[model samples]
Target: MTRPDANPAPDADAARLAALGYTSEFRRDMSLWANFSLGFTYLSPVVGIYTLFAVSLALGGPPMFWSLAVVGAGQFLVALVFGEIVSQYPLAGGVYPWARRLWGRRWAWMTGWVYLVALLVTIASVSYGAGPFLARLLGFEAGPASTTGCALAVIAVALALNLAGTKWLAWAAIIGFSAELLGALVVGGWLLIAERHHGLGVLFDAFGAGSGSGYLGAFLAAGLIGIFQYYGFEACGDVAEEVPDPTRRIPKAMRMTIYIGGAAAMFVCLALLLAVEDYGAVIGGADTDPVTTVLTEAFGPVGMKVVLGIVLISFVSCALSLQAAASRLLYSYARDGMIAGSRLLRTFLPHRHVPPYTLAVAAAVPALVVLCSLLSTDALTKIISFATLGIYLGFQMVVLAALRARLKGWRPSGAFTLGRWGLPVTIGALVYGVLAIATMAWPRTPEAPWYDDYIVALSGAVVIGLGVLYLVTARPYERGDAPAGDAVPGGPAAAGTAPSSEPSTRRRP
Candidate 1:
């Protein structure tokens, strides 16, 4: 397939940026394929399904596979809403800039803060999850210390590739996308053809799973499988400035990520579900590692090792894309003077056009998070639970802001739009986001400590509370160093005007 905007004009992209009241700081080296690849790799079906498949299967039985379809449809609506928003406001830092222009400074700050933290946590979680695979592949014992060390190593490698520049990042994403997709197809197809042990009826069988409320409660609890798999599409818009004709291409890339990534995830899950030989054992908690057991039986020891290597690559790419997204968000915040050390954080390399300091922070924070694993075995699990909740909350904030903007008569004015469907899509996305957040934060772990059950909600509250305290005391929005609200008329496209070559006036905090 031909790449979208195969040879886009840099001047045109820069002009679009200028019209949006900002100069292009990054190289527009990313084609639509590159953008989609970044999002796809971030979504990383192989990583998400591999990490959560066993847990989801154990929690919701074979019926849990349905959650992928349910959440995919809902997230498709979100992608539509986000597509319209990004088309109109194709700015770097995605949710932050989109929210700011749609609503106000305060709203944008909070949205960015929540989303930023979630991205960082996600980076840590992905890296940490990769630890055991890496250790296993390297013939090392997968203990707490070894796993943490491997996690740090993954973070470092991803950070170095990102620091190399936009071109390298795009290439890495494309490579990772290729390897992961091929691996999924080969493995999933082989499983269905050769290793299938259950019939289609297995999907309906609950295997005596679920609590007193029955399969309904268990299935909802397994929603994380789909919720976690669908998000990385937003990473496409996060690097808006790096993509040519972003208003048009970014939206397409976002949707493609969901369609293709969701399909891959569902295929893998279905294959794995059909291939499981002992549903009763898995569902009854006797088989804690059903995925490994199935793979070992199907592929034998050496083939399983090769699959593990592929899984490790997927994890690295996911972490790499996440780090890139997080850094762009931090750069966006700093560029707007919304955070301390704004000058340093916003400094883009003259040649590479990447924010080194922000990238360092993105890497450093996750590395520190990985270190937390030393304190307890379950720290990683608690940390990962917050990642999904925080991300959904952040997404809902943007969805809510877009709805508010629509009610105030803010029609999307860009190369792409939903036309009459805009309001309905926005409303649907918001509703889905809210319900997903509730499901993620619901306490279901009655057998564990109270804190473990409430970790998702508590972690989110802590992040939000700290953000509120800082917002109230520091009042970052009052700085007024950058454009705070929507561009006049219908944005750069509708206005048919360009901002001055000079940077927006800066105000000291």
Candidate 2:
């Protein structure tokens, strides 16, 4: 088939079409189930497990389980907002395009910048966390060096599979995601048996290892962190353009993904609480890898090894999803001229119908991040977390802005409508977003030697700084006369204009 923007006379036009996923080069022919399967397979219960450890340690024990619940509820609300927008504007650019249509390009650029950084750091952090799981499974030491190597190896394999085109990534996600879910259920059941014999008193006890001074606030923050585990499920929406019946299927898939993943996570978290040996040991203790201790306490050596295997597989799946998400993000940004070397980064391999250059560019930073773990593990982890949270903040802003637009009588018909629930859900997401940001900086101690709060703050600043840099360097690329959603059906070019996909209302550039 001829590409949409293909020009037999010009290589430049052909390259442009290929960059936009219009070229026959890297086009994927996977069935809808394959794409949906990829989503289900990439998102597993282990994400909830790993994130639960982070929140529990930060906010204290048992109480942290409630935090996960809260995070899930808050995310449900936010997901509603996204569901509406995605159904109406289901495209590859995802949030950026939605925000640009509702808000403006300058703001959209900034939003995309932050989201891109968030996606990048997410990939890096998963890579870092994958190492310990592999080492434990293999009965090898899981130091910084070993973990880094394992992460790099996973990234290498996943990248290669992704470069093979959509089918391989889809199947890999299915296998990896399925194993993680089953393993989580097995571990949860083991913990449940342990809980039943031990009694349910600890389940009701709000007490934890913290000072009990600000338990509510701490739990709230912990829940936010837990919700972060289920973060990338929205990547399903980002790739909607590639999916068949995307307007109807993507939002449905998203709802199912979140609820299924959340329910599985909740069961495991409750079981983990019952099986916990030392609340203080798992909480106030500075162990980033609480899963190891939790499993060991519940199932002995055999259980610990099994849980480790599940976690390793989970991370591998997450790494694959992350890489896939990042490539699409880069491709989206480049197609819109938001990034440097738009033509090159957007180039697709016609034979495979894939964005090979975008994949290469996306993988470069993460590989560096994984390698840098050898130098300073603590620093890398802190920075990655900071970056992830910062992106979450940006997402919050965009959702609220779009919600506000809807409230002002701006309605677009789509498959997923928030309906009467729109205002309340949007409000809830905004409130939770504010609280989450505030709590992300907590447990700060002057004497702790290293503070993640400062790192998070600095990372946020750098993200904004990059946006500023883009504005300064790419001002000429900004199209001031682009139409809004109502003005163009397909995009800017559809309105008989120069196809300025930039946010049309903003003039700061």
Candidate 3:
């Protein structure tokens, strides 16, 4: 956690970046904690648990909380692999830049395409989920229409803060992280200490009440909650360029975010599950939300409302971090002329160091998606499942790409490295990723509508399919005439230069 290298000067930082084939353009204004807070807030335990806890409990009973532990262990493997890549490349777009650096422009383009869609949809999903909590806090009926309205409002405010400067977002994330952490510990601990509705063994009870995917099937279904909750840790690497000493700090931040955030998530979820007073009513009754029932029973209505108010802080901060990460992805792609309107997206506000067009795109897409909630919240929920699946796919793609690169004799020499442990670690992460995606995508619910069951996989396939179509048709050429680096040892001549034995040996004409 110590400053990896004695606070390198701006010139030295710029030089380090040049070795990786990029110029330091943005304002490196974020401090160490702020950098760490970005990932922590994005992976907000409060938001994840409040939104998905009830759904998981219903699917697989209290035993569903076990999946949280399983997913956390898998994702920690993922974070380690990401740490190596981010430390070496350290680009604005976390996945995109790493993919492009390791492979080619085409691979990078697809990575950006899929990840950007995932982030935007996630913003919309997070916003829609927040609507009910906010409406309840404000004493309004949280109908479809009202929730959609609230989501749009949140999108606008988050975009504004992102466009202003790092200072605004830094403080917002700090406050949100602090509040969410304290709220989880205090609230979760109180529920365990004061109210003991069920024993600890309840977490292992497989309530195979559902017709589809009996006990084990429902357990897999419940894994969706943990898979969705763990991803925001990657948000740290998304803004790596803006953080000081990114090579050292961002990797550490990435791992700690998962460690601390994942633990908090598991603790809160276990506490809430153990506090469930009646499994039959909360899990099987018509038109019941377990979160609402448990909160009201444990803390009374007034206290529940107060807790919901704190949850709003989490929702708002999540929206802000997601939007920021998405915009950076856009800017990273556009800077290399990979996407349309690249000129505009590449433009950054001189003083603010913010890419206005990218931020606008980030907010606008989510706003449009939120509009769908007006039709049917149920329909929107099915569609939002795509967000979780898509993100997992993106993460897996990077892991696979890294493993492939490693097999081809690509050694990771970042400030952080796995050395001999790289191959096994990446392989383990990929196995977990593949299983998680397949489980979610499988059509296990025969009683439910077909569209609902296959929605996640179908939608993700469509998005990736579209990216493939663009790649084949446009046949996009690699842009930027910068000097090459050793991303690939014996690959194509990068940047209008002859192939060389070493990537960094090639200099500009």
Quick one: best lDDT, which candidate? Answer: 1
Q: After superposition, which runs of candidate 1 have C-alpha atoms over 4 Å from their true positions?
A: 1-8, 211-213, 487-501, 504-509
Model 2 lowest lDDT segment of ten? 1-10
Q: lDDT winner between 2 and 3, please give it.
A: 3
Reference-based lDDT, residue 390, model 1: 86
RMSD of each: 3.2, 6.4, 3.2
Superposed by TM-score, candidate 3 places the C-alpha of residue 121 at a distance from the truth, in angstroms, of 0.3
- Which TM-score value belongs to model 3? 0.94
User: What would the TM-scores of all predictions be?
Assistant: 0.95, 0.84, 0.94
Tens-digit per-residue lDDT, 426-474, candidate 3: 9999999999889878887678788766777789889999999988887
- Please tell me which model should have the higher lDDT, number 1 or number 3: 1
Give the per-residue lDDT digits (tens) of candidate 2, residues 1-509.
11133212334333433333232233334444555545554455675466446555546556666666777777777767777777666556567766766665666677777887777777777777677778778889888888888878878877887888776776777778678778878878877875443456775565565465556655555554465555655777667555655555667666766777778877877776676665665565565555666677667888677677777777777777777877877776666566667668767776565688878766778888778667774744474467557657776867766766766666656656777767777888889777766666554544555644466666677778877887788662364333333312344432234534433212221
Give the lDDT of residue 274 in candidate 2. Answer: 71
Best by the TM-score measure:
1
Find the 10 residues in a row with the least total lDDT in model 1. 491-500
